[model samples]
Target chain A: MLDQAFETLKTYDWGTDRNLLNPIDEAIVASQADPAARRGLEGRLVAVLKTDVTRAAKDFVCRALMILGTADSVPALAALLAEPEQSHMARYALERITAPEAAQAMRDALPKLDGQMKIGVIGSLGARRDVASVPALAALLGDTDTAIARSAALALGAIGTPAAAKALMRTKPTSAEAASAVTDAALDCAEGLLAAGKSVEALAVYKRFAGEDQPKHVRLAATRGMLACAGK
Target chain B: MNPSTRKISRRRFLEGSAAGISAFSIVPRHVLGMGQTPPSEELGGALIGCGGQGPGTVGGMGSGIRMIAFCDVDRRRVENAAKRFGAKDVYTDFRKLLERPDIDVVAIATHPGWHPLTSIAAMEAGKDVLCEKPMSRFIAEGRAVVEAAKRYGRIFQIGTYGRFNASRDPKQILIHKIMASGLLKECQAVHIKRGGLKVAEWSGMVRYEVSDPGDREWDLYCGPAPLRPFHAHRFGGTHRGYWDYEGGGLADMAQHHFDPINWVYAKDATSPVQVEASAPPAHPEACGMWGWVELRYADGLTFVMDSDEWGDRYDRQTERDVRLEDLSPIDQQKIREMPDPEPLVGFAEAVKTRQQPGGHAEAAHRTATLMHLANIAIRTGRKITYDPKKEQILGDAEANRLVNQPMRAPWRVV
Candidate 1:
């Protein structure tokens, strides 16, 4: 039945009709059925996924790749994400995979992304919460994309590492939204660090934020973090 | 020629109906194919406001639309604005320029107070309008302009510019589909905390002139709005302090965020739901300079919007299983490994076939109205029943009166 659906979708000629996801949905399920067929299907999926036009195809491909969860799919996904032609859907699917191999691949790709895509990649890394990607994620605190830097801070919090907290403190947001995101991300990272028995590190971060000279609200949050650290 | 123009030129222009160049473009490819060779560089547009947001609109638009003319009530702003963009035409009065018929498009980037009047005037003069968002200063004015477009058959676009991938941005699409699908058990409560800029009269350096009593065009400036003292920054072009040109932040960001819940979940306009303002009007209160406003749709879905509030409680992961790191390289490579379709461009293509344009005007209107009423709720600090069908506020006579202000005569919108 899955094969039949895939055959139907592949033949449907989605040349102009982009709204319907039924065809791609079937393809993903079909691709997921067997590993032996995965390699061939992966190439086809990669083509549709890269065009940034095939929404359903991308969805199916992403889901199928996640099912495959092998080392082979990693490089292709990374390369597609790097290109302008990559669909947001494909990038989104890649972000969802949790295989350790997938994490390692992401860790390797961190140095190459600069400016927008770098921020995007960092954000994806943070969401995946791959602890191994911490050093690279930590380095992004000083990234030029304040949104990326802000996301990095939050990603660190979500990852819950002391290093993530330390890096979040160094980020400066240019806009109010960026500032708020950075502060919140830092606070979460700080709390995570404190929970991980890095009280001194958390305290320093809190002190910097809590200082009267710092951004008033960030400073206030830092003070609160310090008080929380003191067990008051 | 610019890319858009060039893109249009390549298409074949049949006699009546023309094929669109791309789903993303508003112009039909056939029309472009029939036209003479396009311009060499950026396609220029005119801006009427020449104020705070006016210049920014031109800047944000980038090469998409060039600034060819600058028109403002004040001579100084018109000159200054024109200079910034190297705009060749400067008009103290917008009427003269609007009559010229040379400008391709006109952006009505004026104060909320002047939006309805200026936009209607520009539209009547047969120009496509990229009017600023929220679409109207008063509720009735918005309705009037919507009618005007129908009568005139003009391509009027609102500037509510939000990044809505409602069909593909899984989180957004999922929520809309869920709400539309009725799968959420029940929408217990929706608390939307929006922290953004308050539309101050002259908060920025952009300035406007006081209405000269003798100037006939002063009547045009005051079109459809109740006559008030010549304050600099009342609605938008003011230089003094903030004034009630519109309903403050309530009219600004609150209108935006409030619309999502109301539009997503069908709600009634009529029937009063109690409303209470958190802070006193006209005074800077706490860190939350903006106040908390709550409106209960007739469907029992309570929409809460707080301006100057802190933090988003709704996690992206919670909504759609998408994490921040989900966008990473290795994992992302995993994505290229998968396949999905484009949403907006798809819809843009759909529009050519005479189908809906992503979210249609009705959808936009529903949301815009929701936002507008929330402003009324905040300003009056009284539970105001809204009648969506009649497009009027039911009880609270004062609030109802405030719903549509007295328009400046002769230059009326309708």
Candidate 2:
């Protein structure tokens, strides 16, 4: 099914390629059983994706992204993820891979992604429940891309680790979303940490998102998270 | 039209006559027949929307055409533009400016809200128009503008400017040319990245601030949008954030990125499948524009259009923040080898020959539709369906309503 779709994409004309995009996508999503054939087709699809050639090439590149995103095709997908040559499309495909292996691969390769790709990788970790990645995720709080730092906070919350919660509390918020997400993560992290008898860390974690210098909403939420965790 | 008495030099006239008198005689008398073209009949130009885009366009154009008139709601812009361009007349009202018989071309660089109405009005007034990118704020208005141009037989060009962007740099042009030549065996994907810096705050060169008291003219600026506060920044002010006026950066810049893609594609298509926007939410200082929007085309192709919120690395490296550079030299040389003609030059040439402009209303509408769809999909947090042929929304009824907007009371494009 994937081969037929790519063949159709190959023959598809530039201007009207939008018509063929849906079926090709359907075939990709529907082709579950044949992993090897799907891998071969996906490779062909990726090859067409990188060129600055026709709009079709660009369009095909994006479609290839969706295919690479599938969870089952781990090794081939990981190979693409690790290859810097296809970094642009690799970033797009990273978000699609939801499995633990894919998440671990992305996390292991996290330091390698540029600021932009780092954000995508962080989001993937948050989605994949990578609790063991708390330290790496915590370190990204200072990522050049504020969005990446914010995503790291969210990933910590998803991981639900005490150390992650403590880290979120210490981090300064930039954008409203980043601040809000950090506050939520810090609160959740405080509760988890306090329950584990990590009071000092919890208090510190609770202060950043809720402190007087922070916005009223974040401050209130953090305070509440701290109080509830301390049984006050 | 005697060859000797005509303005054409005797030698050239004799040579032309020797070749084919009857064939050359059939040509329009004013064009090349007697060669006595009137200087006074030179093409004249006027500009509507004298704000940021308007003035910049004039400056970029240098002194190509005769600037005869200027129009804007603000007297200050009119005065400055007129003084700068030596326009014979300036008016706060556009209707009066359109009345000039000498003006053959009109540049509709007005706010996005007024684009459809102004362009349609200009065409109705018997003038060709060059409207800014994302030509219409709403779909119905775009359709109306297209109808008006067709009915009046007027020339219409949508200003995406990406066609001219790649032409500015040789190396980038070369890269594009190589890709165009199909020499690159297989390109897995191409990403068009722009800086993540807030455009509203970028240069600090232009300040857009909304005034305190609500002015009566606010309704005019709000033409097709719902009634809202008289935010000066939303209209002609310095802090023209995309949230209040346009669909943020995606609407403001996607046409630039999409132009090259459209050139490569032979068809006019809209997003038939759902597009996803995995972006951070809005910030107070900045509008809720995306870090970037990941658009999945119907063919399963995904286009990642970044708003400055994503990151500024690409912007720093390329030195094209708001402004764009053309394809690299390698791309340009490669493009030269391809069969496709240069799109913008095609339009300019057509202007001289009275032929249809490239990237015509339909093409502009298609690209604009994608931009709007991307914004809508991101805003709605859902994948929306778009049908290019009917030029209407599909499946998502609520999203369909967003496809067109009702004009503010009394400011009708029809």
Question: Each prediction's Cα lDDT score?
Answer: 0.51, 0.56
Task: Quote the positional error of residue A53 for candidate 2 in Å.
Answer: 58
Candidate 1 lDDT tens digits, B240-289: 22323544455555445544444334331232244444533322100123
Question: Candidate 1: which stretches are off by over 4 Å?
Answer: A1-232, B1-37, B40-44, B59-66, B165-168, B181-186, B197-223, B226-244, B256-276, B279-290, B308-365
Error of 1 at B248 (Å): 1.3
**How displaced is residue B391 in candidate 1, in Å?**
1.4
Top candidate, metric TM-score: 2
Assess the local accuracy of residue A165 in candidate 2 as a C-alpha lDDT between 0 and 100.
68
lDDT of 1 by residue, A1-232 (tens): 4445454444333232322434443444354435576666666655554554433344445544543435556666776555533423234445545456656665676676555455556655665556777777777666666666665665676575766666666666666545655665665566556555577887877776676665433443455456556654
Looking at candidate 1 chain B, the ten consecutive residues that score lowest on lDDT are B6-15
Give the CAPRI class of candidate 1: incorrect
Model 2 scores what on Cα lDDT? 0.56
Chain A TM-scores of all predicted models? 0.70, 0.63
For all predicted structures, in order, the TM-scores are 0.46, 0.49
